[model samples]
Target: MLDDTLKTQLKSYLERVTQPFEIVASLNDSESAREMQTLLQDIAAMSDMITLKTDGQDARKPSFSLQRTGTEMSLRFAAIPLGHEFTSLVLALLWVGGHPPKVEPEVIEQIQSLDGDYNFEVYMSLSCHNCPDVVQALSLMAVNNPRVRTVIIDGALYQDEVNAREIMAVPTVYLNGAEFGAGRMNVEEIVAKLDTGAAARDAVKLSAKAPYEVLIVGGGPAGAAAAVYAARKGIRTGVAAERFGGQVNDTLAIENYISVLETDGPKFAAALEAHVKAYDVDIMNLQRADQLVPATHEGGLIEVKLANGGVLKSKTVILSTGARWRNVNVPGEQEYKNKGVAYCPHCDGPLFKGKRVAVIGGGNSGVEAAIDLAGIVAHVTLLEFGDALRADAVLVNKLRSLPNVEIHTSAQTTELTGADGKLNGLNYVDRVSNEAHRIELEGVFVQIGLVPNTEWLKGVVELSKHGEIIVDARGQTSVPGVFAAGDVTTVPFKQIVIAAGDGAKAALGAFDHLMRMPA
Candidate 1:
């Protein structure tokens, strides 16, 4: 805990930094023992402030404080700032310094009507750039409605808390004692949740439902392309997506995708979505389709049931649901995802340009990212849990020939280490020698493989042994009026151009099928 004199100094420093035109008062305790309590109270009084109290076994109670006054803010971390936590503190201070603009009055009133103290805490890692928008939206509700207090916790800083909550991804928001929302959330949806009294049961019953002619599931490059092509063909197409851009949106860049020389994932996704919207496509964001039931007495009609209980019926269905990256499931892997660990090499590799990067897995994607990064990054440490690289001979040769690339055969990642909130490096154990060595790296990319997004399909469609949707040459699935394309299907390459072409083929197949049906 901070002493009275130190607390006063902190307050003074904050005031000086923020330069709040409004008169600021510093409340300090005369006694050293009472200082910590006073500081906590002072922080609680501020409009937007966070006070972190740390009581580790070895060290004295360290109280880190941050406060915002107008345009400026001050950060004080009592613990020895190291690893991801240090980076988290810097970002927290930056967030305080740039307080979001006041929300609209109607929105404020809607949030304020809720009775009782509702505490919403969102746990996220800094690597998720999409999370800040959600945090800002929640903060607006907190500022307007005093009863609703929203806290954004850096997942890395609160690893134990994240583990207790069983957080599997970034940008997971918890309302009160239960999970409220995850990923990115718009302001309107959040306001609706708060207005419903924070009752998950009640909230679930109040969402809206709609039907579509052509319901496209997934939001990856393939899905987006399908939506665009279908909409342009004068078909009433609607996209039901868990996320706007799926796996492609999480990428750093797509240089191999022709025409676009080099582009980031989020930016490319935004462009793709915008292009789809330019037509008449209805994009239902953040909606996950859980089940697909064949419509009774229908000419190739399907009813898609969403996880949110909303039902969408369509004459045709296009499943472009892409795959998810596989993880090692080792200790600290989940805690360090997006902190020092990442899944997409193209997305995060540039961030470590001219620095060392570790690529996990012996597969094609792992070897490819490693070879790609070797050209730009200073050094590439490729760790393959197996004795040999599982990629194609050409890729393996390319990787081996790179001067900066080091292949670690039969090496397993044991631990991830970092200082502040950024990745510092990782430790690996050699299976052959049973010896361990740590390498300093700016990033680690996990490219073991991908699990197809076909779990929900179950009995709805025919899938290959690898779980990939089995589709005909014309992009038609076993089920009539339902088509599968891109990486989700058993197609050859997982490139963006191939996905786009697959999307086009699916749309044409659906159009031909729709034309043959009687009115």
Candidate 2:
């Protein structure tokens, strides 16, 4: 029998180790087993860093074996792996092995070159299956490089941390101190920022005193288009954005946009940014607009305040601020989001081919999701708590025509169910009938309406009841010298082509305002 002194010493040693470890019990006697179980439970309760398992069938075993690796450490349990527990055994082996298969060697080198200690934490829910590849890639990078440490924090497990970080979506990677990258990024692209130390810098630098003909906020389709048009017109233009692509980076495909029959959002945004960069347009990234006020000199110039405590003077301002997705405030919704529950149908639809899925919300996004998923998934159940869909006639017709789509009006989701630590189905109730039903689905896509990203512009510009900026045909806001465009503005459609065209109009309007300025 193991003495209390020996158990106490083992517990003390285990507590000091930072590496991930699994505990395996092999004691034969009932008293010894109880003590070992208690010790394991105490350790697990202390931190999420440790895993525990018990093995009590073998009485002949006198000793246990322990193996250590880079990622996981394993201890042999005197029991057979069977039934549901067999998977756990496999997981223990995999965890202890530390090696998670193989990835591209170039990807490894790219991650290894990154200087300084980087705690790259990716917040993801278990439901987002597609996110695993991205997480795995990041994990592989961490394995290859000592300076970089990758961790996948369950969004549900750490609610307070998620709230503090303002994580709205899954697969959100926080680098070092601030929010670094979002969505899925390839290894090469991630390395590019590290290689140049551009992303690692404090912030994008801009000349404080230099006067510009036009200053554009945001860098999505609208903002990028405005920058290109203004630069071509020989106007000294500058664009400041938190991120270059804005909301367009979240998009998966662009079939409706003109001149581009088929294109990915990132690729399109990259091309637009490149075209603008080819000219003399100055692009400042990772800069947030704090405020806008009248300039000292009259004639339509404005003073733009930045989050970095910097100021810029501009002849005119074009606000191409876009819209953000509405979130489902359900339990485990945030945790499993990006895992099985997603916001953008276009971004994640193709990934769930021949899978059973459900779409929440009855608005335009809801109808769009139903139509999109009907073509891809084996079956799609559109759940709307409203009486009817609020989409345009064209979209409504498309959604109704899909045979694989099933519309459930006045339906509300109560809970999400999962198995094997992954999303499996959902429990929903009918609003009118008060009847509840369980659905077995591989994915749940939230198609709720978008919220305009105009909270920052409150009191600065005239906004509609829905918070959309009120802009004229030329993308000129009610306030002279201040222009708005894209979905954030009073645009009829939130299409890429429409946003691009509106951006052009906003830039032209700014240029006109600039030309009339007093020299």
Candidate 3:
């Protein structure tokens, strides 16, 4: 049964349609095919414009095709359209109804100039805001040229493809049977890759001339705050990050940022980028800093080597590179990821509502997830690798107070078990008893400790035993002209507000150092 909330939204989306299209659904006798067929029928029945036509004569598997009422432009869908993909299916149907995407003239000309037939397959999730932009851009290319065809696949729906391509992220593109990069990308960048190949994507090189006074090496809240503060001082500033949003892009909800009631990761990240861009901060996104070359002489600029073959020089550098989630690399973990295995409880917990789920690792994050899931899920199981829980006593008491909560200490997760292309259960073992156990659950949240992204800075900067860069009170690193901030630094708490404050302090410290320099 479909959730009433989703049903209401789907109906509302279908009602606002400006045109009509036909949805030709075909099915086989297989179980998966039948299930997919039923899902399509249920959706098609919602609107008069949506038509379901079953073709058993030529049907090989559970598949459906979408074509305009009078046009030959048809797109094929070979999986069940559910979860975050529901949005993608909704948008695709609207586009089939004569709603052409807007495109730039230069992009159109580039697409029109292509000679050979090319099919651009974009793997995406409905929850990903970045996916819509790439999908729309490629859809424009496919519509503008007859030789080009683009298809957007929900990465969660096609489990086999996800396992085959090793797709760990959303909005991953596969060009002509080759794996392209992941992350949010612009239309011009995609076209550049398509026209001249991967080499063309890295054609824009960073210049070392006219070094900025302050350069922030991250794109999260910390880097954004730093850039804003530096730019406000009327000093040249630059922001370089592997991705503009950093770990904030992976988060779902934020309620404790001060003054903000509620906001999601993508929304907050967009606002941060917009705020930084409001100033004269030079944004060099999609660039990873590989090595940092400290300035040798006074007033001389430091050079930052990039992973994609470029060098950016700045008078002072602020390192705010954020931390990434430590994934539990057990069997079926990657295969069932985004299927039943998830890392961020905030981002994906709502998807598993009313279902039983488990939390791995007995840290503060696991206890918090158990408490949060207990309210939405049918049951919650907390598993810990240690003999005793590492969470605070208050959290332990609160968690024990929950009626549906269960805790297993010294439990080591062995494998994630799944069937029918979805996770169904989990297998683990007890360290003390030397016994094995299995639990029927739909979701697993890995909440192990976060690992700092400071391996690249080893030997270049002084680091703690855990690979975190050691920073003083003023955010100054062992290297004089370099500074560190955010989770990447020696900060105790890894909060958005804390990172923002650290970034601001780093920027001010850089400016202060610049002021004492002999001009």
Please name the candidate that would achieve the greatest lDDT relative to the true structure.
3
**TM-score of structure candidate 3:** 0.70
Q: Candidate 2, residues 57-120: lDDT per residue as tens digits?
A: 4332322223343433213332232222233233333433353433356456567677777767
Q: Model 3: residues >4 Å from true position, as ranges?
A: 1-148, 153-204, 329-342, 345-358, 367-381, 387-406, 413-444
Using all chains and alpha carbons, the TM-scores for the candidates as numbered come to 0.61, 0.60, 0.70
In Å, residue 102's CA in model 2 sits off its true spot by: 26
Candidate 3 lDDT, 332-388, residue by residue in tens: 998887668877665455556578999998888889888888987899899999999
lDDT of 3 at 99: 54
Query: 324-412 in candidate 1: lDDT tens per residue?
Result: 88787776676667665777564345445577888998888889989888976899999999999999999999998999999999998
Better of 2 and 3 by TM-score: 3
Ranked by TM-score, the better of candidates 1 and 2 is 1
- Whichever of 1 and 3 has more TM-score, that candidate is 3
* TM-score-sorted candidate list, best first: 3, 1, 2
| Per-candidate alpha-carbon RMSD to the true structure | 10.6, 14.6, 6.5
Flag regions of model 1 displaced more than 4 Å.
1-211, 297-300, 329-359, 363-381, 385-406, 410-445
lDDT of each: 0.68, 0.69, 0.78
